[model samples]
Target: MGKTTNALENVFELAYNGKDYAGALGRVKAFHREVAESLAAGAGPYMMADVNEGFRDAFEALEAQLATVSALRDYDEQYDQVVSYGELLASAFVAHVLNDLRPTRWLDCRPLLRTDENWREGLVDWQATEESLRSEVLPRFQEVQTIVTQGFVGGTADGRTTTLGREGSDYTAAILAYCLRAESVTIWKDVAGLLNADPKTFPDTVRYPEISYRETIEMAYYGASVIHPKTLKPLADRNIPLRVKSFLDPAAEGTLIHDCQHPPLAPAFIRKTDQCLLSFSSKDFSFISEENLAVIFGALAQAKLKINVMQNSAISFSVCVDFSERRVHQLLDLLREQFTLHYNTGLTLFTIKNYDAASVARLTEGRRLLLEQRTRGTFQFVCQ
Candidate 1:
């Protein structure tokens, strides 16, 4: 889990479950103290006074904010305003580390209204964000080579802090690159490069030396964990190449995603774990017509449930989504009156792009499949 999740879990364990907000805050304060102490053991040229001061300031501010809270959400905005504040505190620690290393300017992109959408998850407001960045952030880059800032967070014009969805740092980088019109954007990862399959799951995964933007998008959309389609969109639009480099081995060439052509190779294997397959049958023996589909889609949209894959028959429709207990139940509540519902949970959705018979067989060999769909270039199956 990421830092934001870890911090929230700490609060959730105490404040939500244990009903001890003071205990949670105490644990956080002690943790911050330990961190400051450990860093001081080897404070060479770095200003230990500044680090100590920064930590104390942040601790006091966070304690004051959390002191007023009972649960995560009392009377604030949606997406749990209190939790979002904790998220910002988590990200600010990263900025603190950067500032300690060098003369870096730290900023919260959220308060600047760098991205739009008041929801917890956000998308770029290109015109407004670009203007904001060009005015605020760009000038600082001219003064200093490196500036540290928050990712996964932006704000609406009203200054309600919003976030670019989870794992949104890449999207944040893309936004910065697009606004700055940089030469390229590179994401440093643990992996050697972009691979056809997750190395941990598949033993013999192969890396693509270079790939096109479209292929990257397809892989990301299906289940590939390398780069998100959201991150690629802005970069692709600008024709800016993205390099997936290895932080462990900087000498490695890694993979490059640019405007280039390459021969088709092995089928890419993507596995999305913890999926739910829901089948909706008409109360009457009616075909799953456009009207039925429209109703189903609208309900799903209203519930904020994204359909990963779907199929339709004469009298029923089936769709796959990430299994969230609350959201799934909410969707079912909305549609139960219209259609008979049956669902399978704890499933894995396996997608194979540019698939072949061998690849499909290897994945579905021993599994009891819930749903399967195939097309010319893609094959997908949901299995428990």
Candidate 2:
């Protein structure tokens, strides 16, 4: 859905921001036509029949709705345009899927998923979304039997578009399962299952046949790309299991996250690259205390910069976070006058869960560590 989502966002950008509805329509036609053409050339997803025929028909109808420039005069209307375009794309894709598997129904969660009240732009309103799912979606869900809704996209009370955070699809699944009180949630991936380390990064990666929710949450929090960070909480809250299975070998026994009795798991390695280590010290040469920490945390929350790994010394508090230029600059602006700051970019944060001395030594052997923190179950380090 990445490519599809990009196409939809491009349409929104060109039409709403650029104020070029005709150009937006042109891009929609171009990109979707290319997709349809590539599918004809046998380049797209596995389709049994000419799925493009259905998509093309539905997409043409969507194309017809793009020229409603007068309808997008206000902010709310502009948000509607963004969301409507996204829904139209979803509808078109669902129609395409319907062609592939006939007689199977598709459910659209319109009255859709939503965001929290204060930050209406894209942050999900978990309470409202789940509540709406029970009331508006459940009855429709029962009749449809199967659902294929778009992820990352939601709505607001004022009928405006909102998005969940990036890579929010897995979170979407978790939300749906929690609301529905589903038996289990299965996420089919390209790998065997949940691995102790990303196979691409570590050739000796070990798969977890069974993992606990607590362990899985720690892994995801430490920057495991296999699942979204926010995904496990909802599933864990209801004591629901999550399965990570390979799409290639669906029958193969895959990793399961649940409260089951299993042997001690292997050390899990999680690495986050493009990090920036921010160190702040008081100008007055004061020790790092509760008051100082509070000010730093407040600035971080305001800037929305998550500390991947953090440590404090007598005189300084240091944090390693993802290097977002905009957010970092904003944080610097908020705290520059109060404290002296030093930051190093282009760093990597490596977290080893259930680690041993050997694993810690192996990672630190070649690199010069910028910061290191070791706890009972986890060890984290940042290095250039």
lDDT of 1 by residue, 276-337 (tens): 99999999888889999999999998777889999999999999998877688989999999
Candidate 1: give the clashing pairs: none
List where candidate 1 sits over 4 angstroms from the true fold: 1-33, 44-46, 59-101
Q: Would you list the C-alpha lDDT of every candidate in the order shown?
A: 0.78, 0.76
Across 194-296, the per-residue lDDT of candidate 2 in tens digits comes to 9999888899999998988988998998999999888899999999899999999999999999987777888999999999999999999999999999999
The local distance difference test score of model 1 is 0.78
Q: What is the lDDT of residue 191 in candidate 1?
A: 96
Error of 2 at 199 (Å): 0.9
Q: Please give the RMSD to the true structure for each candidate, in Å.
A: 2.9, 5.1
Candidates' TM-scores? 0.89, 0.81
